[model samples]
Target: MFEQEDALLTIDELCSILMIGRNTAYRLLNSDAIKAFRIGRCWKIPKAAVRDFLEASHTVL
Candidate 1:
């Protein structure tokens, strides 16, 4: 889903990729599960983190 290596996804971009709302995105950001950082008041997520989150999302019942 990500086209660039070493590219950072903005909060909006992350939300779009995750197909989630702003509040939920922020909630995830606040949580420890997501790998993210901030740049002058904006949240920046690495491209690889998308894959990591997706991979971690699945579990055996």
Candidate 2:
């Protein structure tokens, strides 16, 4: 779903892509709803994970 090869998105980029606030992004990361990894104090998220989250969220519940 990403154009770059193995692109890692920053929290700010993620927030922009999802049109969500920092609090919601942190909640998703903390809640494990969106898979991500930490490098030191920064969180790095995969584009695939965000795509997956969007796909999952669109499912009828």
Q: Pick the lDDT winner.
A: 2
For residues 1-61, write the lDDT of model 1, one tens digit per residue: 5866758898888888899999999998889567889989999888777778778886521
**Which residue pairs show backbone clashes in model 2?**
none
**Candidate 1 off by > 4 Å:** none
RMSD of 2: 1.7
lDDT by residue (tens digit), candidate 2, 1-61: 3787767899998999899999999999999999999999999998989999999999945
Backbone collisions counted per model = 0, 0
* Model 2: CA > 4 A from native: none
lDDT of each: 0.83, 0.92
